[model samples]
Target: MRIALIGRPNCGKSTLFNQVAGYKAETGNFHGTTVTYTESKVRVLGEVVDLVDLPGTYVLGGSNPAEKVSHDYLGDHPVDVIINVIDATFLAQSLELTLELLRLDKPVLLAMNMMDEVARLGIKLDGPALEKELGVRIVPVVASKGRGIKALFLEAKRAAEQGILQPRFDDFQDDPYSRHKAALQLSQRFAVQGQRTLSWRDRLDDIFLHPAYGYVALAGVLLLFFQAVYGVGQLIEPPLLALFDSLITNLNTYIDTGNLLGVLLNGVLQGVMAGFAIVLPYLFPFLLGLGFLEDVGYLPRIAFLMDSLMHRIGLHGKAIVPFILGYGCNVPAIMSTRTLEDSRERFIAAALSTLVPCAARLVVVFGLVAFYLGPLYAFGLYLLNLFIIALTGRILTRLLPENTPGMILEMPPYRIPTLRAVANKAWFRIREFIVEAWPTLIFGSAALGLLVFFDIAKYFNWMVRPITWLLDLPAEVGVPLIFGVLRKELSLIMLGQALGNNDYSAVLSNAQLFTFTVFVVFFVPCVATLVMLKRELGSRQMVWVTLITIIIAMGAGLAARIFGLLL
Candidate 1:
C-alpha cells in the first residue's frame, strides 16, 4: 500500500512525516521547504507500505514548482491513501487544502496537527463534528511532541486497507477560490472561536517580526550562534590537533623522514588529522546550531527580514534560505535552489549562494584571520564577502533578467525544537561529509604525499604560482590553493605542511595571511560541492559556475591584496 502525506505550507505535514519517516525529508517552518517528494518504506499494521512525503501545496492546480511537483506526483502515481495534515490553530485557512483533497476521492485521513498549540490559544475544535461533516476520519495530533502519531498511522493503515474513499464535495465549486469559501464555512460550523487571547506566539512575533528590532535581534542571534559554534570548535580542536601531531612525531621517530615512503604516510596522516582534528570539530557544532535555527522557525523570519535586500539582486526572500544554508555547507545550499520557480533564479541563487563562506571555508577564515588578526577582522572579511556577492549578483542578473514574482512566504509559529529532531537533522547533513568526503580527504592527502615523494608536487605548485605571485604571496602557498578545491580545510592543513610549520603567524606576514585567506574564501568550491553542483545544475552549468567563481576569486584576491597592503 502507498500512503501520502499532503497539506498546505507550514501546516506541520512534514513534521508529521518525520515522526514516522525518520527525518527522511527536510522540514522547515516555511512554505516550499520541501520542493520535492521523498519516499520511504515502513510497516503499518503488520503490512509494509510505501510512505511518500510531498511538498506542501494549497491547491492541486497551483503553478509554483513545489505545488506543481506535488500535483503532478499525486496525479501520475497511484496512492492508496492521502493523509491530509492540517495546522489545528488555523483550521479555517488549512481546510481550504483539506477541502480540495476531498475532491480527489481518495481514502483521506485528516491529521489535525499542533493540537497543543490550539488548546493553548483557547480555541475549541469539534474534531468529531468536522470528521462527520466531511465524512472522513480525523486524528488530533501534536506531531512535534510525538503525540497521537501512532493512532494517526494506524488509522491511515485502516483507511488504505478498507479503501474508504472520502465523500466528495459535490456542491463546492471547481475553482480554488470556491473551495476556499466552502472551507471557511466548514471552519465556522465546527471550530468555535472560544474567547481567543494573545498567546506567547503573538507576543514573540511582535518582537521577532518588528522592523527595526527584528534586524537587531537577527544580528544578535546570528553572532551568538556562530560564537557558540566557534567556542565548541576551539575547545575541541587543539587537543585533537596535539594528539595527531604527537602521533605524526611518533611515526617519524620510527621511519626515516628523508624517504619517499615516509612522505606518503605522513601525508596520509595529515589528511586524517585535517578531517577529524580540524574539520569535523567545527562542522558538527555549526550544523547543530543551523538545525536549531531551521527547526525553531527562525529561518523564514530571516527571509522576511532580508527580502528587500534580496530584491536588490533580482531574487527575493526565498533565495535567502540557500544563502543561510550555505553557511552550514554549500551542497545543501545548492540543493535548496529547487524550491525556486524560475530556472534562471535557481542558477543565479546557486551561483551567488556559493560565495557565502561555508563552515569548511570558515575553517580557513577563522584559522588565518580570526586567530592571527582578530574576530573583528574576521567579521569585516565576512562583510566584504557579502559585498562581493552582491556585486556579482548584480552582474549575473544583467546577464539573465528575471520576470518571476516576489516571494510569497509563510510564517510558521515558533515551536520548541525537539532534541531528537535537531540531532537527527545535524547528523543527516554531517553524514554526507563523513561517509563521502572524509575518505576522499584521506586519499587526497596521501596522493599529495605521493606526489611530493616523486618530486612532481613542485610542478603543481609552479602551475598555481601565478595566482600567489600575482597576490604577492610565497610560491609554496600555490600548493594549498590547488589542493584546497578537494576539501577546503586542506588549504590550511597543507599550508602548515608546505611552510614546514604549524604556526601561521611565525611563517607568514600579516598581509600575505590576509590576502591568501581572502583568495580561499572566494575560490572555486571544494570537490564535494562541485559534485553536488553538477548533480543539481547539470555538468555544463557546473563548469560554467566553476569558471565564474575562478574569475571572481582572482578579482577579489587582487582587491584584497591591494587593500591588505594599505591596512
Candidate 2:
C-alpha cells in the first residue's frame, strides 16, 4: 500500500514523515524545505507500505514547484491513502488545504499534529464530530512525541481496506444563500466553534508579521546566530582536537613502518584526520544548530525580514537561506537557488553565494587572524564577508534590470520541532556534505601529500616568489595558497604543517596573515564550488567568475600589503 503525507507549509508534515518512515529527509520550517518529494517504505499493521512526503503548499492550485508537484502527484499517481497533516493550533487556516485535499476523493485522514500546542493554547477539537462531518478518520496526534500514532495507523489500514478513500467536494461561492446553507449544515454536524477566539497568538502574529518589527527581529536573530556559531564552535573545538590526537596515535602505532613510505602514509593520515577533526566537526555541528533553528520555523521570518533588502538588490528575501547556507559550503547553496522562481534571481543569488565565506574559509580566517592579529581581527574578517556579499548584491541589482518579485509566504507559528525531524534533516544535509565535499577534501589532501612527498612545494615556493614580493608574504606561504585552490580549510592545515607550528606569527607578520586571509577569502572557491558554478551557470559564467575572483583577490592582496608599507 502507498500512503502519502500532504500538508501546507510548516504543519509538522515532514516531522511526521520522518517519524513514520524511519528515515532522514530535509525538514525545515521554511516554506520550500521539501521542494521535491521524497519516498521511503515502512511496515505497519502487518502490511508493507510506501510513504511519500510531498512538498508543502498553501493550495492545490498554484504554479509554484511545490504546488504543481503536489497536484501532479495526486492527479496522476494517486495514493491508497492521503494523510492530510494539519497544525492543530491553526486549524482554521490549515483546514483550507485539508478542504482542498478532501475534494480529490482519496481515503483522506486528518492528522491533527502538534496537539500538545493546541492544548497549550487552550483550543479544543471535537475529533469525532470532525471525523463524521468530513466522512473520514480524524486522528489527533503529537507526531514529534510519538503520541497517537498506533491508533492513527490502525485507522489508516481500515480505511484502505474498506475503500472509503473517495474524495468529497463542497463548493460555496457567488451565492451567499448556498454558502450559508452549506456552512450551517457542516457546522451542525462538526460542532466547530462559529469563529476562532482572538488569542495571544493572534496578537503576537500581528506584531511578528508587522512590517517593521518583523525585519528588526530578523536581523537581531541573525546576529545572534552568527555569534552562537562562533562562540559555540570554539567551545566544542578542544574535544575534537583530543579525538583527532587519539586517532593519530592509534593509527601510527598500528601502522608501524619506517623511512619515506611511513612519512607518506603519515601525511595522508594527517591530512584526512585534520579534515575530519577540524573541519567536519565544526562545519557539521554549526550546520545542525542552524538546521534546528530552521526546523523551528525561524528562517521564513528572516526571509520576510530581508524581503525589502533582497528586493532592493534584485532578488527575493527567500534567497537569504541559500546565502546563509553558503557559509557552510557554496556548492549546495548555489544548487539550492533552484528553488527561486526567477532565472535572473537564481543567477545573482548563485554568484553572491560563492562570495560568502563558507565555514571552510572561515576556519582559515579564524586560524590566522586569531593567532596573529587577535580575536577582534578574526571576527572582523567574518563581518567583511557579509559586507562584501551585501555590497556585491547592491551593485549587481543596479547592473540588472528591475524586476519585482512576488511574496505569498505564510508564517507558521513557532512550535518545538521534533528531535527526530531535526536530527533527520541535519543528518541528511550532513550526508550531502560528505558526498559532495569529502572526495574533494581527500583528493586535495592526497594531492598536497604528493606535492610534499615529491618536494614540489620547493618549486611552487620559488614560482610564487615574485607574487610574494608584491604581496609582502613569504615565499613559503605560496605552498598553502596553491593547495588552497583545492580546498580552503586545507590551506590552514598546510600552513600549520609548512610553518612547523600552529603559530604562524613566528613565520609571517600580522600584516602578511591579514593579506593572506583577504586573498584567500576572495580567491577561487573550492573545486566543488567551481564545478557547481559550471553546472549551474554554465562555463561562460564560471570562467568569468573565476577571472574576476582572481583579479579581485590579487588586487586586494597588493592593496593590503601597500597599506601596511604606508603604516
Candidate 3:
C-alpha cells in the first residue's frame, strides 16, 4: 500500500515523514522546503508500505510549481491512505486544507502535530469532539519529539485497512473563502482559547525579528557560521593532507614515477585526496551548521531580514533561502528558486544564485587565496562575489521587468535543533557531493594527467592563449580553466599539477594569483550545477546564464589584473 503525507507549509508533515521514514526526507520550518516528493518504504502493522512525502501546499488549486507538484500528484496518483498533518496551534487555518483532503474520497487520518505548541499557546482542543465532528481519526502528536507517533501510525494503518472515507460536508464547495469559513465554524465548536501569555519564543522574537537588531543578529550569526567552518577546516586539513602525502611518498618509493601506472595513481589519488582534505573539511561543518539553522527555525528569520535587500534586486524575501543554500551548493539552490511565484523572479534568482560562491569555489578561494595571501584577501573575494551577484540581479531584474511580490513568510516558533536530525541532513547533503561529484573530479584529473603525459596539454593551452592573455594569466593556466567547468576544485588541483608543484607562488606572482582566483569564482558553475540549471530554468535560459557568467568572469579577471598592475 502507498500512503501520502500532505499538509500546509510548516505544519509538521515533513517532521512526521522524516520520523516514520527513518530520516529519509529533509525537514525545514519554511514553505516549499520539499520542492519535490520523496518516497521510502516503512513497515506498519507487519505490512510493508510505500510512503511518499509530498510538497506542502496551502490549497489544492495553487499556482506555484511546488504546490502544483502536490496538487497534480494527488489528482493523478492512487494512494491507499492520505495523512493530513495539521498544525494543532493553528487549527482554523490548517483545517481549510483538511477539508479539501476530505473531499478526495480517500481514507484520511488527521495527525494534529505540534501538540506541544498547542499547550504553550494556551489553545484547548477537544480531540475526541473534533474527531467526531470531522468524522476522521485525530491523533495528537509532537513529531519533533516523537511523541504519540506510534499511535498516529497505528491509527493511520487502521484507517487505511478499513478503507474509511468519511466526508462530513458532502456538498462542500472547494473554494478557499468558503472552506475557510467552514473551518472557522468547525474550530469554534471544538477548540477553545485559554488565557494567553508571552512565551520565551515570543521574547526571542522581539530581538530576532526586530527591525534594527535583526540585521545585527543575522550578521553575527553568519560571521560565526563561516568562522566555524573555516576553523574546523583548519583543524582537519593539515593532518589529512600530511597522511595522504605520506602515503603517496611511500607508494612512490616502489612504483616508477614516469609510467602510466604512476600517472593514474598520482592523478586519481590526488583528486580524491583534494576532495577529502580540502572540500569535505569545510563542507561537512557548513552543512551541519545549515541543518541546525533550518531545524532551529532561524532561516526564515534571515529571509525576513533580507526582504528589503531582496526587493532592491527585484526579488521577494524568500529568494534569500536559495541564495543562502547556494553557499553549500548551487544545484539545489537553483532548484529551490521554483518556490518563488513569479517565473521571471525564478529566472533572475537562479541566475544570481549561480554566481554565489559554492563550496567548490570556496575551496579555490581558501585553498589558494587564503592559504597564500591571507584570510582577509580570501574574505574580500567573497564580498566581491556578493557585489557581483547584486549587480547581476539588478540587471536581470530590469531585463525581466516584472512587479515583485511582497514577502509573505511564516516565522515558525524557534525550537532546539536536534542532533540526530541535523546529522542526518548534513550526511545526506555531504553524501551527494561525495557520491556524485568525486568520480567526475577523479576522472577529469586522470584524463588531464594523461593529456599532459602525452604532451597534448600544450595544444589545449595554446588554444586558450588569447583568453589567458586577456586575463593576464600564464598560458599554462588555460588547461585548468577549461577543466574547471568539470568541477571548480579541479581548477585549483589541476593548477598545482599543471605547474608541476603545489607552491604556486614560485611561478605566479600575487597579482596573477588574485586574478586567477577571481576568474574561477565567477566562471560558469560546475557540470552538476549546469545540468541542474538547465533542468530548473530550461535549455534556453541555461545558455543565457552560461554566456552571461562567462562574460562576467572574463571581465572581472581583466579588472582584477589591471588593479594588480596598478598596485
Candidate 4:
C-alpha cells in the first residue's frame, strides 16, 4: 500500500515522514527544503508499505516547485491515504491549508502536530468534534518527541485500508481568503475556548514582529550570524589544519610509494582531502547553525520582514529562502529560483544568489581577508555582499520588465525543532556539497599539479597578467582563480599552500590580498553553479550572469584598491 504525507511548509510533515519512513528523507524548517517528492518504504504491523513525502505547500494550485510536486502527485499518483500534518500552534492558518486538502476529495487523516506546545499554551483542541466535523480521524501528535505518533500511524494505516475519509462540511469555497477566514472562525470556536491565554510565545512574537525593533533585531541577528561564522572558524581551523599537516607528513613517509600510489596520495588524496578539512569543518558547523534557525521557523519571518525591501528589487519576500540556501551552495540556490513565480524574478533571484557568499566562498574570504586584513575585514566583506545584493536587486528590478510579484508568505510559530531533524537536513545539504564539489576540487588539484609539472602555470600566470593588473593583485593569485572556477574553496587552499602560511603575507600585500579576496567574493560562481544556471534559466541568462559577475568583481576590486590607497 502507498500513503503520502502532505502539508504546508514547516508544519511537521517532514518530521512525521522521518518518523514513519524510519530515516531522514525530506526534513527541514525552511521553505522549499523538499522541492521534490521523496519516496521510501517502511515496515508497519509486520507489513512493508510504501510512503511518499510530498513537498509542503499552502495550496495545490500554487506555482512554486514544491507545490507543483504535491499537486501533480495528488492528481496522478494513486495513494491509499493522505496524512495531512498541521501545526497545532498555528491552527487557524494551517487549517486553511487542511481545508484545501479536504476539497481534494481524497482520504486525509489530520495529524495535529506540535500538540505539546499547543497544550502548554493552554489551547484545548476538540479532537473528536474536529474529526466529526471534518469526517476524518484527528490524531494529535508532537512529531519531534514522538508523542501520539503511533496512534497517528495506526489511524493512518486503517484509513489507508478502509478507503477515503471525506469532510462533513462543504460550505466554504476554495478561495484563499475565504478559506482563511473560515478556518480562523472554526479555530476560534473549537480550538481556543474562552479567551486564548497570553503565552510567552505571543509576547515574544509581539517583540520580534514589531516594526521598529523587529528590523533592528533582524539586522543584529544577521550581523551576529556572520560574526559567529568567523569566530567559530577561528576556534576550529588551526587545530584541523595542523592535523591535516601531520596526516600528510605520515602518509608521505609511510603510505605513498609507487607511481600510482604517489599520484593518488600527493596529488589527488592530499589535495582533495586537505580541501575538505579546510572547508567542511567551517562549512558544516555554520550550516548546522543556519539549519537550526531554519528548522525553528525564523527564516520565513526574515522573508516577511524583508519583503518590502525585497519588492523594491523585483523579488517577493520568499527570495530569502533561495538567498539563505545560497550560503550553503549556489547550485541548489540557482535551481531553487523555481520557487519565484515570474521569469524576471527568477533571473534577478538567480543573479543575487550567485553574489551571496556561499560557505565555500566564506572559507576563501575568512582565510584570505581575515588573515590579511583582520576579522573586521572578513565581517565587512559579508556586509558588502549583502549591500551589493540589495543594490543590484533593485537595479535589476528597474531594468527588467517589472512583473515580479509581492511576497505572500506564512510565518510559522517558533518551536524547538529536533536536533536529529536539523542534523539530518544539514547533513543532506552538506553531503550534496561534498559529493558534487569534492570531485571537481580533486580534479582541479590534479590539473594544477599537472600545470606545475609542465611549468605551464608560469606562462598562464603571465597570460592573466592583465586581469591581475586591473585587480591590483599579484600574478600568483591567478592560480587560485583558475582553480576557483572549478571550486571556490580551492582558491583559499591554493593561496594557503602558495603563500606557505595561513597568514598569506608572503605572496601579496595586505591591501592587495583584501582586494583579491573581495574580487573572489564577487567572482563567477564555480562551474557547478554555472551548469545549474544553464539548466535552470537557459544559456542566455547563464551568459548574462557570467558577464555581469566578472564586471562586478573587477569593478569592486578596483574600487577597493583605490579606497585602500586613500586610507
Q: Which candidate leads in lDDT?
A: 3
TM-score of each: 0.94, 0.82, 0.96, 0.88
Report residue 75 deviation for candidate 2 (angstroms). 5.4
Whole-model Cα lDDT of every candidate shown, in order: 0.85, 0.73, 0.86, 0.79
* Root-mean-square deviation per candidate: 2.2, 4.5, 1.7, 3.2
Error of 4 at 487 (Å): 1.7
**Which clashing pairs does model 3 show?**
none
Q: What is candidate 3's TM-score against the reference?
A: 0.96
lDDT of 2: 0.73
| Models ranked on lDDT | 3, 1, 4, 2
Q: Give the deviation of candidate 3 from the true structure as CA RMSD.
A: 1.7
Instruction: Give me the candidate number with maximum TM-score.
Output: 3
- Residue range 277-378, candidate 1, lDDT tens digits: 888888889889988988888998988889898888878998998999899888878988887888889899999988899988998887788778877788
In the range 1-567, model 4's lDDT, one tens digit per residue, is 888888887777777888777655655566677777888888877778888888878877877665788989988888888888888877887888788887776678898898877777777888888778778889988888788878877888898877774535676987998998889988887786435677676677676778998889888887888777777777887787778777776887875434554644565754666565677767877887888877777888888788888887778889888898888788878877887777788899999999999888888887777856788888887878888888888778778878655666666667676787778778877777778777777777666666665557878788778888887777876787877888898887666544445457776777887788888889889988999999888999999999989988888888889866864
- In candidate 2, which residue pairs clash? 105-166, 105-167, 106-165, 107-165
